[model samples]
Target chain A: MSSPERRTADGLERAQQLVRLKRYEQPDEGYFEGFLKEFQQRQRADLMQRSSRSLFCERLGTYLADFGGRRMLLAGGAACALALLFVRVAPEGQPVDAGFDAPRGEVTPVSAGPLFEGEIDLWEGMVVPAGDEEIDLPLFMVEPFDSRRAAGEPEIIEL
Target chain B: MADVKKRKPDEDRGLVERAKDGDTAAFDELVTKYSPKLYGLVYHMTSNHEDTNDLLQDIFAKAYRSLRRFRGRSAFYTWIYSISVNMTLNFLKKRNRHWKISLDDVDSAIEFDKEFIEQTSKTDPVRESNIHELQLRLNEAMMELSDDHRAVVTMFDIQGMPHNEIAKILKVSPGTVRSRLFYAHRQLQNHLEEFRR
Candidate 1:
């Protein structure tokens, strides 16, 4: 490798020196002042847009993208999943909410009168007390299915 | 010179430490100190001012965001410069080749520069070319070089950075830096032969 000083009179040196004119290419007057102000504005906007929590989460996400951190996260996730699977697979375990006193009798399906005629009986088979007027559930609001309207199968409703 | 050299990095280290501790003012100081230099680096590589300004902002923002991970293994100056050069190089790759060369106005002080007078005083083709024409031709010649070569030329020639510092910023060995400069200079000479009498 040759030093630039040792080749001052050569064409390479002249070309190198010519490029020195590039130093004069400064921005317009007051550009730096404007630049700094614009930068601060941008910084404040950035701060307003992204909270420290998001910044930390972004950094954490970046850190966890690396090999060691990814492996650690994967191990932790596997452990949590294993704990969940253990609890779920244990049939002898008590129901999750044992204290909530949900109704515990057989719920036989009930026959329904046509809706729209206002003869719908909602509490026919459910074991509510005879005068239990507190359960004021609305009847189904659809028109009765017509035998003449059974011409075509219903379109599959994509959930 | 040696004492000054030793003190600069220590000063930068103090600022960097403070900035890492969430001191926005410290980071602003760093930005104020390096923006002009990095602006030159990006502007010369791009031959466009708007792109340089945008890239400079992004470079500092990225540095501030990543400051916590900066481990002082390198000087803050070198680390920021590394980020600057790499970011500019990546940006150049994505920049459109057909984009217009929107140059910043040459500083008025160039008229009184001894080197500029000497350069323009010669009876060569360069002396016949006006400043605007010269700037265009020179930028065209530079843009002709490959991105890697152009980066080295911008650092070593235009910015007057030492080959070792450039090597540090570019993460290449000094020999590779020298090799790239050699070839880059050769290419520029061929393209800008008007500079030679």
Candidate 2:
């Protein structure tokens, strides 16, 4: 770092004095007049070439600026307030909302009225019996010519 | 420190109002009023006549486009200076280190300036140096500075703007402006002290 000594200041002061000579560097005479004319031409060309969107915005801005500072401030404040409305702040002690309008449907438990007193039957129709019983045939008495007995007592003849 | 005309805010308000109302004549007045000063500011920064010319044209064009946004929050002087400084700084940033220094002709009127001659007489080396050569060396020394530093130095040293005014233009604190000026002056001294100073 250069110290702030008298000798150092002198050297810098001399250099600074030289730097001041930059003021003499000027464009040729009548440059300002020419600059204005050239600028006017370019300004007209640029404005002519601009899209309607930019022109509208420029017109709107100029209109707004014409409405005075108080109105501008009011408009700015209203915009901020509107922006704040859209920004939902989370309540204290609640987890912040990261979801953006997620689906929300309610759940309902199915009601088949109240329960009755009974063991619940889960296997009611699948049982079968074991086959190990002995069978005796009755002695058959042979009765021949039983056609008349067909109508007697509703015909209970065992075969 | 320069023949650059000072701005008049009261007169500016009327002209700005008129210009805002689509008075091309009033806008022309502003363009005429400010071009030379703005030219000097930008020329010193870029160290190129063509770049300065183009940039000056652009600066005024931008100001003209942005006229509606200019509420009297700051003086037109400060507002336009802000625009020029910002645009030139951006231009310099984009053109970084890829520049060829092209300067304008030193006005012949400088020959008749007694104060400059007197100041040079006080310094043996500066007095002994050729005016054209000294001017070139000075511009080269200026280019050695960073864009930010060069900006403050150009505005403060060459343009003779008050530190507070420069602070306003840069939107930085006055201390920042002063600090930049201090370091810039130091660097310039170092560069020029080897021979020119």
Candidate number with greatest DockQ? 2
For model 1, which pairs clash?
A: none
Which residue pairs overlap in candidate 2's backbone?
A: none
Clashes of each: 0, 0
Model 1 local distance difference test score? 0.77
lDDT tens readout by residue for model 2, A1-159: 456576887787877877886776677678888888899898889989999998998888777767876888998999999868756564667755656976668989988973333232223322122334322222242233454476564676689
> What is the two-chain DockQ of model 2?
0.32
Tens-digit lDDT track of model 1 for B57-170: 999888887787777888888898899889998999898877655444334455666767776776466677777767777888888999899999988888777777788889
- Give model 2's docking category: acceptable
Per-model DockQ: 0.30, 0.32
Worst 10-residue stretch by lDDT in candidate 1 chain A?
A: A114-123
- lDDT by residue (B113-170, candidate 2, tens digit) is 6676676678767667776667667778888899999999989988898888899899
What does TM-score give for chain A of every model?
Answer: 0.32, 0.42
> Top lDDT: which candidate number?
2
